[model samples]
Target: MEGLSELALDHVAQYFSALSEPSRLRILNYLREGERNVGELAEACECSQANVSRHLSTLAKHGMVVREGRGTAVYYRIADESIYALCDLVCGNVAKRLEAQASLLGSLAPKKKR
Candidate 1:
């Protein structure tokens, strides 16, 4: 936020908003492997081609993924690998919180009769 102007902040908000959808996250995960054409992504995601295209549009808009046009076909790949690291960091914190909650529940359980 230090160097970000108001418009930059708005763009940043849109970027996060794009990543907020599960479908979009799954698309990014698929791209972690390598570039894939829209048809391939659509098949892997078990959704319609239009749906995949829409998700890809959002991902491309946020610069999370990059695409190339080869003749009439287009392929997409992850533009920012750091997004995976961010996801991992958040996942780890969630795991720790869940473990702590489980431990607390175990302590609060009624004791067995002698």
Candidate 2:
């Protein structure tokens, strides 16, 4: 990032933006198991087909997922497998921070008497 141009940084931001949505993250989780069509993803994500489609479109634009046509259905899968590693790294850091905050809050709480 130190030597990246504005355009490259913008693209990087767009990629992260695509992953910022919970729904899109859920969709990616499902795709991790295997390729799935829009309908399948919608059902798994508990979202409407249209909603999932919009997320998929964003994911595709970021090159995070790829689409394939199977007869009349369009299925999506992860384009860059490294995304899992990146997500795992971020999730781990977030979980650690949350745990630390919880510990701090617990210490600050008033003690209960029997």
Candidate 3:
């Protein structure tokens, strides 16, 4: 928290909030393979082109994805690579917790019924 202003913390929170949406997360995950045009993204994401455009707009606004216009189609790709690492760290912790819970359940003995 040292050397960080309140405004800085709020900005960071906003960045996380941008990633909080499932559709936005899906867009990020799809872009991990490389850039894709809006039409391709819409088909891959199984949503309408307008919906995909909205998600891309939010990502572009937050500096999460880069947009390129080639002729009539617009392409999008990852802008901040660290977002994947952040997601991976959270997933790893959840996996560890689930593994521990499974082990605990496996160790429980079944009670005999009379």
Best by lDDT: 2
Report the Cα lDDT for candidate 3.
0.88
Off by over 4 Å in 1: 102-114
RMSD (Cα, Å) for all candidates, in order, is 2.5, 0.8, 2.9
How many clashes does the backbone of model 3 have? 0
TM-scores vs. true structure, each candidate: 0.79, 0.96, 0.81
What lDDT would candidate 2 get against the real structure? 0.95
Which one wins on TM-score? 2
Indicate the worst ten consecutive residues by lDDT in candidate 1.
83-92
- lDDT of candidate 1 over 44-104, digit per residue (tens): 9999999999999988888888989999999999888998998788779989999999999
Q: Look at candidate 2 and give me any clashing residue pairs.
A: none
Residue 60 in model 2: shift from native, Å?
A: 0.4
RMSD of 3: 2.9
lDDT of 2 by residue, 1-114 (tens): 999999999999988998899999899889999999999999999999999999999999899999999899999999999999999999899999999999999999999999
Model 3, 1-114: lDDT tens digits are: 568899998888888888888888888888889999888889988999999999899889889999988888788989889878987887799899999999898789676699
Model 3 clash pairs are none
Write down the TM-score for model 1.
0.79
Q: Rank the candidates by lDDT, best first.
A: 2, 1, 3
Error of 1 at 110 (Å): 6.4
